[model samples]
Target: MAYIRPLANGNFRADVRLKGITKNKTFSTEKLAQTWADSIERNIKAIPLMSSAQLLEITEADIESMGGEELFKQLGIDLFAIRHCAKLEAINALSKKELLQLTPQEIERMGGADLFIKAGKRIRYKTFREVCDEYLSRWGKKDYKGQMQRVDYWCQFFGDRIMTDIDIFDLREHVDDMIDAGDRATTINRKKAVLSSVYKFALSRGYVDENLVRSVVVDDDTKRRDRVLSDQERQRLIKACQVSHWDKLYLLVLMAMTTGARKGELMSLRWNDINFKDGTAFLGDTKNGTSRELYLALVVIAELKCHQEIGTGLIFPSLELPEQPMDFRAAWRNALKAANISDKDVLNTDGSVKLERFTFHCLRHGFCSALSDAGKEINQIAKLAGHKSIQTTMRYIHQGRDQKRQIVNELAQAFNL
Candidate 1:
């Protein structure tokens, strides 16, 4: 039963009282109050008639007939909860050993690992370590060593745990651990991405319910490295590289600055990859899994001609091991020291970088930033940098304060202000 009365505040009050159920609300008008009372009464009357069995059998049309999900929620009738309970009852009827004996195909036919999780049941799924190994075996060719190392680190903590058992909270704890260990945001995000990939692979094979790693949040604001090299710094760095102990350091640095190619891409270069006539280099195996052409400036081409290797071997092969890429970390650090562009001031007491430091990667940043400052189109910059996304190219572009002011001044002139 329902009733409506006019309140002292010039509003109408509705009261709906049914079998052990009571609801009341005030509305601005009597018609509104009556309508709300009728809705409540209908919802309250409809909930009791919906048993768990009926809830399990409820279709979209039946829910619409009952006034939709909001009405059921208003009457404290959780249709999902009722269905989940029915699922639990069905799962509970099956023995644990029987469930464990079911194959991945059978489990998938029973509504996937997601349904099992909702029904509070555990099935025999592969362990985290096993899934990691399987994932590596199938999809680790692109970055085998790096992905293997990351997987090993994850296995150290979650190797014994079932893939289905690892929830978002567990993943969050791992992220916190990485943060505590002084890992950079970019590094942490990369590790998280690897784990997320594993979870996605598991999800495809019906080993887990969801990719919980998608929920793990890391601070990404610090991921953008805006260390664009100044003209003076570039000059100094080039001069330093020219006099470095490593004879090939100057050419490597020159190509890195001119073409904005990654250290790996440059190091993996071969004699045949370069076309001297066109003054271009073909990067077949780029980071984005696509090939791109890098146009060489005349100076770069001249320098390349001087150090050109004859065969199809790597342009910058290792000195000791001809088949391997050179380990130039010491040479790179020495060049930085000679250029007086050291990160010593930004280093912590334990010699860890406390702030963004100028690295060889910064040369790429400088390349994009210089193009942006020169009024080049973003698409052109992204194409030259081989960035698959314009947003990524945007991160690399760090315009100087003078360039910003000049842009505004140009805008003012155009407006005749």
Candidate 2:
């Protein structure tokens, strides 16, 4: 909990005291002030007690004595720039002599000592974690779990970094690190998108005048993986799952291939989401953030009916935690290996994974590929797949023999050849 008060200067002040750690920032708007208070308090709560104490006890004298640009570096806070004691005195936030005399705890109590020195370059800084906290609190309650997961990932990447210190290069390098570590582009882009959202949130609140995340280039071609299992590969995959005796994994892959549903959406399915008689299922949670009904294949309907006879709640409940969906990662990887879909995993002398990953999401690719090969129009495929945009489905329309033949026939008929 914290407090927000309007000052005579037409600015809003927000302050919170947590486990003796305090943050007090003033903003031009009440919304901004409240947001900062909420975010700072939340971050303080999330921090380990020792780390929070370290942050709280950084003395003003310790910083002022470091002098000019070297102050931030010595403090290990901001690498870019910082406001010096003279500037703080000019703003009447502190007197030069008084600021140098105050302890970090005293600075906190006085609502002075703008956190993070910017190497005398003066960065209007905000903590990445706090900004993410503000981002989630402002618009995240509706999608708490999903949004929090993104926030958590961003916190790990930046770790309470001064937002101004991170530029396009840093953002790109972080994403590249993920790529080199064998993360799928979608995963990397999703994390990048979270940062972008936070920057946008900050921009709206006047935390900073710029949104640096916008300048970071994402591969235009690789936003989503277009991988699909071939006919032989799909057959081998089923056989491998059968051999593994993982009944749930088999049904999970089958459902994904037949329905084009996302991993989370499929995981969320219950007997109630499916209507076996009507051969349809309703998705309450989807990437598009809307609910929609999708037609089910006869085979999928039959599978659901059989499973419903035995399964109680979740269609894919965890083996250990029945209320939650099973972690399909291990079995899925083993199946991929058994199907010979994966390349050699034994590291080379220099040490590198020999294969590209084909994740469970690829099963949705197989579903879309099947439709495109059957000559369904892009819009029809989009509707069936519950995609909010037909443009997204257009990516799946590969030009196979049927499509080529249609193009050839159209050209020939037009020329009367």
Candidate 3:
């Protein structure tokens, strides 16, 4: 058995002096030294020593069952002054503190799980934020707006907690809290999706054993909102866009309403991105890296070429720069106000809207609704909207012709179809 002894220098150490055993392993911290001694004692008890004539035969699993600490002890392994340093060359090596220091962005830059394993020094409880950064850096900035949004949502909902601290219960509570806070079921689900991805990342990296999100039970009391613009509302907003006098805003809206490119991709348009000769606009960066090709109708081409300012690199150059794209927030607000849409009444305190659910994104909805009303195919609609899936495009189509009947019934209710 190992015991603690005081040195002449007034420091204490663990001294395990046994015949035929390594001796006098000193420790600055008494508790650590004691742990070391106890581990060695346990190893000696488990494996009886044998003379040269007869060897103590033990299976590999027998040694492993004692755990890394006891197994190393039984083997009479003396780690360098820093125990972790010596184990760095062995299996099941990890550097907990060092792993904690790396940011998510750093992890993403290191690439996939294989790369992450190679790069991360063993760490304990790698925080969610670190994982988030790595996910973002790996996914890159442009394509991960939704993921970034979810990361922000989690950070705001629950301060900066370490990754290991997250449990299935915490995620369930967070979803419940969002529901109580009056978020749309869809929005809540989207946030859940982000959380799910984080858990998946943890599992893939061997950080967590299971995905907590998969076990989470979402509340069925959530509401589904896929509000699309009516023809009258569309016309009103169109008029508002025209009144703002940023013809590009009007054109941008028209493109979204006509082709259903996402607001960001549309606003990010440049002269070089347009191929007027072939009548197609090449979208370089999009949600999917498909590089969408949108056909420019005659009306779209006319609107674009009419105010085609010379020497401006951006098709929608900023009014301030006259050489760059303009900030669209002020323009968007004015257009909404002109349409008589009061944000206070429409949007909730938490930035979620109820009935007249509206945003720049609604223009794409307007386009989809127009197509659905016109009896377009799901695949055709998906391609036009640049949707990654037919189901995503079909969701905008709605069902049972109820919305379609409502359009006809509106006229009949007023004046007998």
Candidate 4:
């Protein structure tokens, strides 16, 4: 309802009151005052008179637009009390046999399983496998095979177990099992990280109350690798790659050794990423999500030119598929054998790695180490290796014994003592 009245100053005032909400305004003309009052009254009446249960559906913005919290209080609505009563109602409703028969979708529409749990209802939670499937489906990254493998291993271990049931104790047992099976600290930590990521996804979707993986501690006792190829080893490895069965293996190893690019980064490259005239390669996709440029050596550029394809497809496309990146694991192992770079110091009877041996990654280490040995600045090495920190670069920069001895001798000479 609204009332319009004339003021002594020849202006008009309008007052609108409805459902305990009141708003008043002054207008220059009686007609304007009447229009304003009518508008206000209509707007106030337009707001539906929601029940206490339905009031929970109103967002803060909706409340704000409808004259704020004070207006709701004036209308005999207490948000806090409503929420408390709604929780009780929801709990009581869940106890009904008819409500228990509701589909999962209906239950979610009413309020998620969390709501029923608060009501003291023991609901069937999603299995670990179901959670993994959902998590993988939502994964948007270009590379997820390694992550998928880790998730698969977890699903196999925790088969059919509900996510809420796998607590810190189960995670600890998993870690112990891995340790007993001779899994390295690094491997165990990697698996734990993957599980932690899954739990984080589950947490966001309200599948779990907490990430139990956070409570499980795994010791990372594995030492940082300082292995770098010697000059002779580098030569042998290059020659071995050159004569390998896979034609692309040579160029791949060369690019990896010279540019210090990770295996995935190089393998994902397309022909368009290279610039023959500038002797440069543009890496738009990298591990750190930062774009970088790799200056190609003349030898590498020459090899690339020779291997250049007709289209802008992958530089190292699979020979069979021609659309996917080539898998050169077997070829790489063969090259390592040919170069006499043993994968382990003392191989097991089953030919498994008992001790760490030289790997393709050592080529990257060799590149950084070589640059550091040549007196390059730490910052320069970091930029070349696309390392976000100089500390990471330092880990890869292992100087030979002779270089260390020479530096000591030079320091002593300078002291003249």
- Scored by lDDT, the top model is 1
Question: What's the candidate order when arranged by decreasing TM-score?
Answer: 1, 2, 4, 3
Q: State the TM-score for model 3.
A: 0.58
Which ranges in model 3 have alpha carbons more than 4 Å from their true place? 1-125, 129-162, 172-191, 215-223, 245-247, 309-312, 317-325, 342-355, 398-417
Better of 3 and 4 by TM-score: 4
lDDT tens digits, residues 1-417, model 4? 899999999999998888777888899999988887776666566545676556888888977766667656665767755775765576575554545455566567767767777666765468889999999999887568867887999999885887766778888988998999998777889888989999999889877778998888877743456677777988898899999999989999999988999888898899989989999999998988789999999999999988897668999999899889998999999998999888755578998646557777777888899898999999999999999988888888989899999999999999995
Compared with the true structure, what per-residue lDDT tens digits does model 1 show for residues 73-107? 76678776676665556667889777866666666
Expressed as tens digits, the lDDT of each residue in 1-417 for candidate 2 is 689999999999998776665557789999988877786666555433325345445566743432322424333443222333344444355444443444444544443345424212233345788777877777843578878887797788785666655667888888778889987556677787878888898888766667887887667434343556667988999888867656777777777888888899989888777777788888887877889887787877776666674444788888899899988788888998899886324446787644335767667767787888786877888887888787777776554566789989989999999
lDDT of 3 by residue, 1-417 (tens): 588877787666876655355444577777777887777666655544433222234345654544343445545643221233323343234355445444455444434234445444454345677777776777755546766776777767554666766667788887888879987666777677877887787778866667888887665422244556666877898889887856577888888878888866876778878877888888888877778898888888888888675442777767788555578888888898898754433766887755654777766766776777777877888888889887777667643367668878887889954
Q: After superposition, how far is residue 202 of candidate 2 from its true place, in Å?
A: 0.6
Going through the candidates in order, what is the number of backbone clashes in each? 0, 7, 13, 0
Clashes of 4: 0
Which candidate achieves the best TM-score against the true structure?
A: 1
lDDT of 2: 0.69
> Each model's C-alpha lDDT?
0.83, 0.69, 0.67, 0.82
Clash number for candidate 2: 7
All candidates: TM-score = 0.67, 0.65, 0.58, 0.65
Using alpha carbons, what is the TM-score of model 2? Answer: 0.65
